[model samples]
Target: MRSLEIHGVDDLRVVERAQPEPGPGEVQIAVEWGGICGSDLAYWRHGVSGTATMRHPFVLGHEVSGRVSALGPGVDGFAVGLPVTVHPARTSGPLPERLAGRDNLHPDLTYLGSAARDPHTDGGFAERITVRAEQVVPLPDGLDTRRAVLAEPLGVAIHAVHRAGDVTGAHVLVSGCGPVGLLTILAVRAAGAARVSAVDLSPLARERALALGADVALDAAEQLGQDVTVAFEASGAPASLEAILRVVARAAVVVQAGNLPPAPVSVALGPIVSKEIDYRGTYRFVSEIEEAVELLARSELAEGVISHELDLADAGAAFTTAATDPHSSKVVLRLE
Candidate 1:
């Protein structure tokens, strides 16, 4: 088997290794596609948190989908040749947030590909990955593997929507048009928001957001004349956060979904304090995976969103493209 490893900032290595065997209650999957997530790029470039946890040589990739090549002992009801998506959340241990049904908030949790978990070695970015059977969600008969790969990110979008509370009949602003932002727009529209405004620096992203059902797509620099009742700050840019504070109506709910790293970004606290606005953070939701799968199966958002596909051997290029190419919405690595 072959897998990509991150030794340090901007260092991605593709190497050969022995295939992994599934433990009891696990399944070995032949990865078909792996989506390049923003966090993956961050880990690739800066390592993790000022270079401590992400000591050299970690596998990085989380958004993934594939087919079951084999199943381990104690695994039942699922079989070989079944298409599936891997749930990156490993919620087996105790966490106050997870026990309260917010597994996404599990403090000590590790995703498939990370400094702590190293799923790139264990990720679908490789030819094969062995995951707990509980992490595999069977794809429907009609869903293609490429689209099924989206179940992970779509869950993120759905979870963000859930945080923004009662979008129906309200004007909503999504302050980013990346994959997550675009999907958030779709979910917002699906949730019956009266109108949606998407903001991004990329014209291509703005266009895609509109095509995905946003009423308006604005440049990040521009301000919405009217106050939005709800806002999703998917941009991660501090400016976008400020814009949301400025444009969202009093008592509005603003959900921070993007990863703004390197340092804590500053924000204007007055709007939140004076208006009694709800400022919340959302992580990938564990419970919404099934719903995300169902929505993707029902909606057409997954049809044309994938803009690029690269072979696993060329995954380094995929990472670069994901980070620098504003035009590319979703880039997937074909492990096989």
Candidate 2:
């Protein structure tokens, strides 16, 4: 089987490797499609993510959907050839926190393709890979691989919206028009937000956001009036946090959903103190996977988010294009 190994910053190599066999309580998936994420681009460009860097050879994919090729011992109640989406979490220890469904806070949680691993596990940018049975969610019939590939990031959007409390008739602003940001737009719209706006540096991104139901798409640097009731900082840009504070209406909520490494930013203390803004943090999918999947499956159209598909062998090109091309939305690497 073929696998991708990250040797260093901005480096990826396709190499021959032994096919993995599923261990007990695990399943092997013949990867069908994997989505290149913004965090992957950050790791390649900066050589580090958050507080961790590429110290050892690492695999670089998390947004994935595949088919079950083999089942390991103790893994039952599932058939081979079933299409499924991969939930890339490595907190496999018998849970104290996550077992109750709050897996996001599991202390040993190591994300797929991230530098935050202890015994770093490989990801789904290859011919096949093995994962715990609980990490795979079976995709419903009639949902295309592209939509299944979206299950990971759209789940983030869903989590952020839920953190915003009630979006009904609320003025919402999404900072960043990347795949997750655009999907956040769609999610907020679907949740009945009366007014929604998006911000990005890319004109192409702004256009895509508008096409996908964003009421207004503006440049992040533009002056935002005091109308936004809730602001989602999804750009991962350091300044977007302060921007959210500056533009939001009094008593508005700000959900920092972007994976921003720690950086200092000036905030208007008066607004945060006087208006009592609810600033919250959100991570990956939590209790919203089923709803996000159902929404995607029930939508009448493609929802205008997934932009392109490339072969798994061209995963490097997909990352390059997604990192450099502002027009790129979700660049999915299609397998079988």
Best by lDDT: 1
Global lDDT of each candidate: 0.82, 0.81
Q: lDDT by residue for model 1 over 1-336, one digit each (tens)?
A: 788887788888998878989989999999889999876887787776422357557566888888999999999988798999989877656868435877787866767876664332344568889998988999876787888888888889999999877788988899888888888888888888998999987888888989988898888634686568888999788888887888778898999988665577787879899888899989778678888888788887666578899998888889888888867889999887
Tell me the tens digit of each residue's lDDT in model 2 across 1-336. Answer: 877777777788888889999999999999888888877777778877677766788787888887899999999977999888877876757668434776777777877788776556567778898988988788877776678888888888998999889999988999988888988988899999999989998888888889878888888734678888998989777777777787788899999888776676554556677778888888786657667777778773335777778886786788788888766788888767
How close to the true structure is residue 157 of candidate 1, measured as C-alpha lDDT?
90
Predicted structure 2, TM vs. truth:
0.92
lDDT of 1 at 71: 90
Error in Å for residue 198 of model 1: 0.7
Off by over 4 Å in 2: 93-101, 220-225, 267-269, 300-303
For model 1, the superposed segments whose C-alpha errors exceed 4 Å read 49-52, 97-99, 117-121, 220-222
